[model samples]
Target chain A: MGLDQPLEGALAPPMRNGELAFEEPWQGRVFGMAKALCDAGCFEWAEFQAQLVETIREWERTPEGEYASAPAEQETYYNHFLAALERLLEAKQLVAGGAVEARSEAFAARPHGHDH
Target chain B: MSELKPQAIRAEALESLLIEQNHLTAEAVDEVIIRYNERVGPMNGARVVAKAWADPDYKACLLEDGTKAIEEFEFEGGEIDKLVVVENTATVHNVVVCTLCSCYPWGLLGLPPRWYKDPAYRSRIVREPRAVLAEFGVVLDDDVEVKVWDSSAEVRYMVLPMRPDAAAAMDERAVLELITRDAMIGVAR
Candidate 1:
């Protein structure tokens, strides 16, 4: 069927002055990484999407405060999105398993105000 | 400066690791982000909304076949393939959401805002739309019907808000200013 049919559901996105809003730089960066990787054919877009939805669903099923101090809802979702990407990369052998965790821990140890 | 949050660090780590492996370049990742920031965004959707507000034939075509009609503008991205344009009349209002994951009309609306992807919105909007709309400062009259469009990866939706009475004498260019990404998503009037 054509797209003329109205698919009704309640909807609204956080906005600032009628524009798409981003709270942090990494939110966009991680999103870009996923898009860029998929575009480069590292993995199919649908594969990432399926993983993302699964991650969110798993988060939803988890009990409250189970996610390591419970970040804001927005951050929480992106965290799951990030995890999905990591999982996809590891599964595809694009990046070694646990390498992201090791790398992140190393980056976290840098002196204050020093992020490369 | 405060320490970078773990998630941010993880994101950066992923970027750096991918770059190190040659699977991706920093420039390519930046290009995707830059494209969203500068080029592909709601303005594209606003142009479509304005065109529909101005040309009757185009409006009919848009309503009949949104995917084919919007191609006239040559927007980038495959998300528009199943584009569905829903109209808001005096008696009805429309909104868009993706409950499973955040599937938005990226070519038209840009990346969805944080709330759109939050569980609070994804779970609540379908059950209590009026309450949710009220929070967004959109209070419909008791008689006006509200229709929520649940977007899927295959078919995306955008709302065509009614031309405000004030813009009657104005041209399409002027009307374009009246359309916001929020309104096209059925959040604002």
Candidate 2:
């Protein structure tokens, strides 16, 4: 996902014919959550984008097995990404308050994990 | 105590005689599909959304917290290890992704459709959501900022797209039609 590529109205979709697509709606959810998070000041939009781009570039460059079995490295990158996601979701909920109980309860009903 | 002591037989002898057992529990992917087939489909979400559009209190409650709001219909993202719901209000919308090998909440949504787990999307969307959405035929206004989520672990997200005015009064099926997969993710109109 090159930030430089523009895909708005006048341009062609950036993806190639055989390139993978996203599940609609949910795909859009990615941007929506991020935007909401940024707007709420959870993090600066520019900074967030910069981090993701850097991470993506680094991963793309390294071979998958290069960091294999090294728990520290895997956790370092993956955990930071998850943390960012959590912040975004929290901000979105904060902005849209109401009927929060049902949502909270629904989430609670799901298996709450304890990391090994 | 006898001089000719009897040696103990190894437990391996007993274990080797037993037959191997198989499990009924489905793999993560299968379980994901089963849940999608059983619940968490558009109809279910539509019911909740319908309630929100019609009832301010419920909508407020849903906006405040989605997991509990969804339970009103006895719908639970079974086996979905994590659930994160994002609603699109007049001013904001939401989207989701699994940046590290697709750690999604299958419990809320059955198996992630292939594209979500695809390299192209997971690789591109986070960096270029605007361009990706355009590729998918969605054009966002420049002022309406787009946010991209990168998932790792069990956490997963769902976008509650703002109900389009044109979809008003439409049946659940009708309304869902307008809720394109991309739109639900918050990259489109």
Candidate 3:
């Protein structure tokens, strides 16, 4: 049978007139982070790719907890991208271990409606 | 505004962390984003498609070695090292997806469409191509064999769509305008 309904795991990316478009400021920011880091020679593009592939595989292997519940909002593709980027940075010693986690906590603790 | 999602928070955290450590500057990151959004994009792919339609020898070269032929454009970006150009024929149709992640020919087509990166598209396109293509508004005959190319880090793929008969009298410039990014991706014909 044709699977005509919306699939559970993946959400279509944000687009405009069939073109790649970012819906959120962070989506673009993370995308640029990965590309900029590669351009800066922190690691080869292939290295980042390896991390990304592994990250995605890990997600696929996951038993569909958070991803299954809120596929569109949680555990999105960019989440995998961020995970891969974080892993790469830590591996390359570009960022101190746990610094991202620490900083993320700080950002999360920011006042409600904080713009920056 | 709504409270930032954890993913967004993490993205910001990573950016600030990298900047604070001097590993990357916010300006550098912004510049890369701007370049992808403004400078590099599908026009390069359209030029390649148009040239293949206009020149037989160039078409042969493109079909033979996509990587080298695309290099003639001297485009800037990643994901063009080992490109394999697939031609759509009367009976064979080609569509691209990356089941693992979003592995696209960024140098040629720029950033992949969000739907291209969507997990549903990646998984469903391979298994039920005709149904998925129908959703994209591309309806193929029952006899047409649908072939899905799953892009990888090692090799990238771009479909060489057949020039529509309507463009038979059009010049290469006009034909180039007819080529859309989705056509090159084989989502639209």
Instruction: Order the candidates by DockQ, highest first.
Output: 3, 1, 2
Can you write out model 2's per-residue Cα lDDT over A51-86, one digit (the tens) per residue?
554554565567763443322232334333433443
Give the per-residue lDDT of model 2 (tens digit) for B56-117: 79877776776666665776544333445677766554567876665554444434545664
TM-score of every candidate: 0.87, 0.50, 0.88
TM-score of chain A of each: 0.73, 0.37, 0.72
Highest-scoring model, DockQ: 3
List each candidate's DockQ score. 0.31, 0.02, 0.31
Native contacts, share recovered per candidate: 0.63, 0.00, 0.61
Compose the digit string of candidate 3's lDDT tens values, residues B85-167. 99998999999988878889988888877778777787889889999999999999999999999999989999999978877
RMSD of 3: 7.7
Candidate 1 global CA lDDT score: 0.79
Q: Give residue A51's lDDT in candidate 2 (0 to 100).
A: 57
DockQ of candidate 2?
0.02
Report the CAPRI category for model 3. acceptable
True contacts kept of 1: 0.63
